[model samples]
Target: MYDVDTRKRALALVAQGRSLNSVSKEMGISRHAITNWLSRLEPLPRTPPCVRCLESPGIPEDTAAYAYLLGLYLGDGYIISKPKQHYLMITCTASWPGLVDAAEEAMRKVLPWPSVNRLQRAGCVDVKSYTRHWVCLLPQHGPGKKHERPIALEPWQQAIVDAHPWEFIRGLIHSDGCRITNWTTRMVAGERKRYEYPRYLFSNKSDDIRKLFTDALDTVGVEWSTLARGSDPFNISVARKASVALMDAHVGPKY
Candidate 1:
């Protein structure tokens, strides 16, 4: 078994944003050793220690275990690409009745055979149905098509996203879209609800889509400041800009 102190140090290094490879090299340990320790530990429940806490009068040994657990969970864990793509595309059919089937068929025809082969190699596959008129595609190691951007959320915004669960992220996107619909109804009575309007609606879950971009940043330790005034807690323009910047970082080109 690994010593508790060693595990604590490893956790601290992770919080500092050191990659597993780098940490293993610097500490003269194997990545497997770190992974083994992390597997044995539980995630931390409370907020993580700030940079100050890590640098300040050192963390307690017991606290270190919790901190390590938190670090491992909060830190970027390894994403094992099953030779099969494990990602899913969930489209909301409540608005676009027949769009999902159309999208799937179109994708199959338009996407090159090699592209499909790559997806299969990555273990990615497309799933669909015609009767339900709603379809979800599960691509194994699906193309990195979504992750084409560097995240640019402020530290606090990132924290809120990190602190909350994944379900919360899904809820936020759905709720935010709902709010946009509410605003649209008030501003333009004749216009159909945007959510129901298929053309303008897009899945915010795409890796390139930054609906939860702010949350991803928080997981990596960015800080966001609260606004002094405004009905919306976040400044829309700033958030959008940050998201766009993140996309450019990951995607290699802007959309």
Candidate 2:
């Protein structure tokens, strides 16, 4: 077995952009040994949060709908696992019943055999589905706010997003975003006048999630602004009329 210092030196040499073979030759170690060490240094395999989530898989990795569900899951979804069973829950504000319905439909399209239900809590509705494939779809599943910890997309997930960016944005915004009217007053001909305009706002407490939201918007050519409302959740808004219209064409109100 290679000593820790030897392994560290090999990795550091690679970090300086040296070839594995050259590093091995200089260190009098085999090139295969360096290659094996590099492989061992990679991230641990992301296992399912729950073993049961792997039993009966539904949903393939490449579908647009599946990608949409993934965006939704990253934004507002969570998974619960008990021995022998597991459930995927995408929580939405009670006010957005249509969004909840849409989430249900998406899940149904992906998992035909599982029944989807809406569970109403005090101020929210959970679009819940019993599925064993939830963890397989979202290996990033973990406890606490997504931004509080590191968040990243797997290669397959990124590929799906590259192909279906709009659908993924739709899922993200519909779940945590809103198209609301912004009202303002101004002096018109020396008199105060009121006017209203509509914009889209995607809010979340997680900075990482917010970045993901903005990145998706950029990919789709939608212009937006981000704001932190005095300790309130940070949000990105597309307030320009042209940009708002563009977003409306893609991801407007769920209802």
Evaluated at residue 26, the lDDT of candidate 2 is 67
Q: All candidates' lDDT scores?
A: 0.33, 0.76
Q: Which 10-residue window of candidate 2 scores lowest in summed lDDT?
A: 43-52
Model 2 backbone overlap count? 1
Worst lDDT run of 10 residues, candidate 1, spans: 130-139
Quote model 1's TM-score: 0.21
Q: What clash count goes with each model?
A: 27, 1
Off by over 4 Å in 2: 1-62, 231-233
The reply for model 1, stretches above 4 Å from the true place, is: 1-81, 84-88, 112-208, 211-255
List the pairs of residues colliding in candidate 2.
53-132
Q: If scored against the real structure, what TM-score would every candidate get? A: 0.21, 0.71
Q: Give me the candidate number with maximum TM-score.
A: 2
